[model samples]
Target: MTHFGIICPPVTGHLNPMIALGYELKQRGHSVSLLGWEQHREMVEATGIHFVPILSPRQAPQPDQKITSSRRMRLRHKLHRLKQRLQPVDHQAYTQSNGISALRIALAAYQHWSAIALRAAPAVIKAKGIDVLLVSETSYGGSTVAEYMGIPFITICVGIPRHQSSAVPPYMTSWPYQLALWARIRNRLTYAWLDILQRRILRLLNRYRRDWNLVPYTTLTDSASPLASLACLPKAFDFPVSLPHNFYFTGPYINDICRKPVTFPFDQLSDKPLIYASTGTLSNQASVYRCIAAACDGLDIQLVISLGGKGRDVALSNLPGNPLVVDYAPQIELLKRASLVITHAGLNTILESLAQGVPMVAIPGVLDQPGAAARLERSGAGKFIALKQLNAKRLRKLIQEVLQDPTYKDQARQAQAVIQQSGGVKHAAAIIEDVLDLAHISV
Candidate 1:
């Protein structure tokens, strides 16, 4: 049995899928452990997987540290200002400026976390005697750690596909798929610009590689595992593009049976067609929720807004619609009953909605969400509006279009069929085992 070490960001969206994959591997008689911050120890251990604390005591956030908390608040405020600055007029200019701002913030965070991991991960992996590693695609530090130790690792694409292709637009933009030569040129130029922006991050990583006497990466994509790369995205939900031979689409790494039970007020739900709205576990802005409530105010549907555990500050009673607002809701259960979903175009939410045969109105805010939203519109499964362009009237119109038209639901069902056939955690596990076996043979 292979002992696997899982590495990913501590956020809910990334952690949930990686934890589910770890749980599946453990069920198959393999041992699995997650290396993360000490704060997430309880959350990881609760799933029956071992948790290895990676951050030094000094680096870890203290519960009573007012300074750390204040810093976080300030960062949140800065991000909010960036989002607010994105105007509907001059869409291209705003998209570029906002995208750059977001990327700068993300890279800064990653660089900080990666420095900690580089210092701590080698000792942790050695102590645990891990045989294989499963690193999240976004967790570049994990890949570096695996290489430093000369251990085999696989890349798990928990978010959108990050493979660079001239035919596909960058993941940060909501541009639709186009096959024209000019579209390819635009894609190439955007990619070059992104590479230039990421030069500092690349330099930081390469310095460590040179220190370790290992070959330095030329580009960010060079860090991905050559053995295998697994994505939770289904083929039908993605744009038609060629992927690397080692890459495999293994559907979503979801295990409902392994999830902790959540308490939801089912009786409060009305008989009218259900419209479930969420902005995922992060990016919970009160203004976005207000707009959603206003759009659904006079509609015939029953609206339920989930704050994703980040909306405690939002006053529910003051919202325009008397919608059922909760700090958190059992999303999968609600999706089963939902006639439509209004989402932030998060991959997990979109995949879950599709799995339930529910159409969506996507409002992509940041990161890979715009790419996922673009694919949603391209697939005919749903429609999307830029977050800057979102208003009560426009959102309500799209909501009506998705609900009144049967075509959206039909397309969702088609995607549902593909998801059902695509093996989830089990398939991913099998692929990991196969790659491990192949690596052993080569050795």
Candidate 2:
């Protein structure tokens, strides 16, 4: 059986698609294993895949409480609780610094995380006997490891496509796909500026690769996967563009492969239309949650807000009306019953909403979200509102417009049908097998 090593950061969005693909591979008689944070060992192992821990000190600790009567035990418990509370703030400060912009912070975070992943990958790859490696595009280290070991690798674009193309605007912006002459020139210039900004990071990575006697990459992302890659979203969501022959959209992996079932107040539902709002697991800001909650206050609807794991400090008691506030919820299950969704324009959430035929009001926070939101609006499946302009009144108006209008739901269903036909996990498996076959023929 062919063995595959699934390498990615321990974020929920990144891990879900990889795990779904792994399940498809395993069912075809191939073996699959995941390499990620030590804290996620139990959760990953429970999925019946081999879990390889990175053992990095920077990895966040999972919440666990132990009771002990002794003074020493009590002291340790107190310290642990203190650490847990401070972690969110520390992480926020690191991600949102005054001197550095969010983009630079993301690059720095990626660089640091890749360094940790690189240190642990070689031994894991050797031990697992992985023939081909599948890496989420965001996991920069996986690509580095594959290059270092001279192994054929496949890159998975888990979010909006990040490939540099002149046909569409650059990612992480509110710009629409269709641009005038000046705008098109401006888009290319923006890309050029980004390349310049990332030159130092690219140089550092190339230098790191030289230590292992590997060729330098032109850009940080350009040389990550030289063989084949998978785009996890449906083809309909992307603007028209030419791609490499090896690059293909394998549809969204919408299966419940790697998700844990969450309990929500399902029985307490009223006849009013249900609105599910979330800013994804990582970008769940308390202010955004408060705005969404307040907007739906006194309205004839059930509003459910997922705080993600980062909103521990947000107090739910002071919320307006009887809005349901939970740390996490069963998103897919909720979407099935939801008439509308208010999201951060995260690709995962957007795809999920579309797949379930639920219209959305996207409020993109950062990263590729803004680009994805713009696409959503263009597709007629949803609309986007700027974070600065978002308020109780504006959000209420948008929600009413989307719900009262039938075009949004119709377009969402159209996207849903395309997703279904794109041949999700089954198509992805066939692509990987073809790549393997090609390798064998070359050998």
Query: How large is the C-alpha RMSD of every model relative to the true structure?
Result: 7.9, 8.7
Error (Å) of candidate 2 at residue 34 is 0.8
Model 2 C-alpha lDDT versus the unseen true structure: 0.75
Can you tell me which runs of candidate 2 are displaced by over 4 Å?
57-90, 94-100, 281-284, 441-443
- Please name the candidate that would achieve the greatest lDDT relative to the true structure: 1
Candidate 2 lDDT, 1-443, residue by residue in tens:
78889888677778887888888888788888888777777767766878877655234232112212353354345434433432222357432332126566666556556655665576667766777789888777677778777678889888887788766787867788765788778788888888886665565556546655577788766754767888987888987778888898988876674787677777887787899988863333666777888888887889888877555665556777668878888888889999999998889899999989999999876678788899899899989897767888898889888988999999999999998899987899888888778878221
At residue 128, give the lDDT of candidate 2: 68
Candidate 2 collision pairs: none
**Which stretches in model 1 have alpha-carbon errors above 4 Å?**
56-98, 281-284, 441-443
The Cα local distance difference test for each model comes to 0.81, 0.75
Question: What is the number of backbone collisions in each predicted candidate, taken in the order shown?
Answer: 0, 0
TM-score of 1: 0.89
